[model samples]
Target: MSLPVPPGPQYADKQFYINRGYHQIPKLRLSMDRIVKETVGLRPFRPSGPRIEAEQLGSKTIVHNYGHGGSGWSLSWGTGNMARNLVMATPERKIALLGCGTVGIATARLLQESGCEVTIYTKDVPPNVTSNLATGTWSPASRVCDPAVAKPEFRGVWEDATRYSFRRFQFLLGLNDIACWTDEYSVRNEVPTASEHSAGGEVYEIPGLIPERVRLGKKEHPFAADFVTRRSNLMFNIPSYLHYHLQDFLAFGGKVKIHEIKKLEDIDALPEKVVVNCMGLGAKPIFNDDELIPVSGQLSCLIPQSDIQYKLSTEGANFIARKDGIYLGSNGIVGNWDTTPSKEQTEKVVGILQEVMKNMRG
Candidate 1:
């Protein structure tokens, strides 16, 4: 008070850049201990959000909860709740749940909470199905709809889902080994080309969904790129998260059967009066949704680095290090269904990271 305080810009510079002791962020370096493994996953992306509606088929009432695209995990809790409210409208005490992916499991769990006996029918379960391939970021509106085709009325529904899903994710926090944690940094040298089906546009632009992002200056950022920024979001370790949910589902009297359905008639044959279809990508062929497409995605798994706690992405590529290992992801190929992990693509992404380091040193 004796002396006049420094101006705002000078104070910000002093606090953020000049004060090395207080402004301590990590210098980026990725260990080259050859990637332990690599894998690819296909995102069941629907441009018009997930199909959450009820349709009558023969004597059975069918409720749809599929085609969530990249937003499956983020939207699962809300959509499950939405579908369950529909299921509750009926008096059926027993329900048939199709598929065992994230959405399927979430639906079954929600139904269990509603006091319904659940039978999960599927060809595969977690860690083996397509759901395991997701990078598991908390982008709820991702690839959920196409703007041109999206109605003005959809904003209300989309906003509702985002709100509900966020509330559910908070309950999963503080599990062992970063099953749900935050990635705090993302440095971009260039802007990513937005696709028509890109999930980052209007849906996330809603009020009070995501927090504001910060643009980092030279002292605040450690990357080589001319531009740097930081934003925080959730990442669900799909393997562990599913394991936690599936185990509890069984404890709560849920039954799992390994059976594949080839046609709608098979579903009609179920004894349960109500069937909730959370088949995810499998619905593409069975339901013949022409608008749905396979989004080819690949992630390279490097050894876990405790020091690297943030995320990085440029162009169509994404790089992040989680508790398990480093994940290097390529851009989604909208119509591509190939799940083969490309050695060349992984190497290309690695080079991008290396270049970043080199530029930082220079």
Candidate 2:
């Protein structure tokens, strides 16, 4: 039998508590390390243009959108929304989506709403593969290139995409079991409250608040900061969430074809002439997009700790509670594409957690 769902008493709580005493997540420690090592920035890449040559594809007929790097999830809804606006001018009644990841899913859904027949051609589907492996945090970490090297117009697109996605997530939160949106506390080290490090601060509040049991103490903080703690709402268990999206797609009459293509021509050959390619890092091989590099992220999971309902990060080490277990990650430091958790890495993560907890007690 499938395991029982974790209790959601605290998650349902509406009034998010901001731990003012000490921070738990290691923002200060991680920032200090990044500044010292000078490796804290995201990969240096940006959209060169609509990943497709308008002249080559016949402008005003086929639309091109993809190459989001890492912000694909955080910014996809907005980008798809913008892409749909462009479709208004296209005489074509249907659109073909190239990838089935979050971007492809959002694009297909949006196209359906526009009264268009959408078909997604992908080798993978929800829960089984692609994107569900993501830690699924809201932070726009990664997917940024050097401003000097990026095109001027692309920055505005990124900005609009991000804002648009934030609102869409808000709307999905109340949609029931379909989308699992919850406020999760992101604990961090206590920096001086007046410092810029406190932008937006921790202990964020989310909508659709469900009353949950409170776990608080006068000095209940993590090991990093002076009484560092937080009450934030972060999405957990992405597979279940993706399942809802897939179901919704089918219910809306959208069709998904499970097929692997060896060349971009295969995609171009589809019955639907208008194609929007959102192949993520896969673009490197499919479209010979060497610009689309995969920056790997590795996370170590401790045996489930229900009471560990908050997240803590310091010096690249991070711990966030999820439906599966407490997700411990060194964030960007654990090496990209080495997605597996090693014994040494696991031990190191435990050490980091000990330090964070110890610091919080002090």
Which tens-of-lDDT digit does each residue in 1-362 have in candidate 1?
01232222322443344534233444455544557777877778777667898888888888899988778888898899999999999999799999999899989999999999999989898888887877778777777777677677767777788788888888888876434656455556554232321224434555455554555555555566654555666787777888889998999999999989999888888889899999888988778889788877788887776776766665445666666676776566788888788888887777777776666522
lDDT of 2 at 19: 50
lDDT of each: 0.75, 0.54
Clashing pairs in 1: 45-69, 47-145, 49-144, 143-199
Cα TM-score of candidate 1: 0.88
Q: For every model in order, what is the number of clashing pairs?
A: 4, 30
**Most accurate candidate by lDDT:** 1
Give TM-scores for every candidate, taking all chains together and pairing residue i with residue i.
0.88, 0.72
Task: Please give the range of 10 consecutive residues that has the lowest summed lDDT in model 1.
Answer: 1-10
Q: What stretches of model 2 exceed 4 Å from their correct place?
A: 1-62, 177-233, 333-340, 358-362
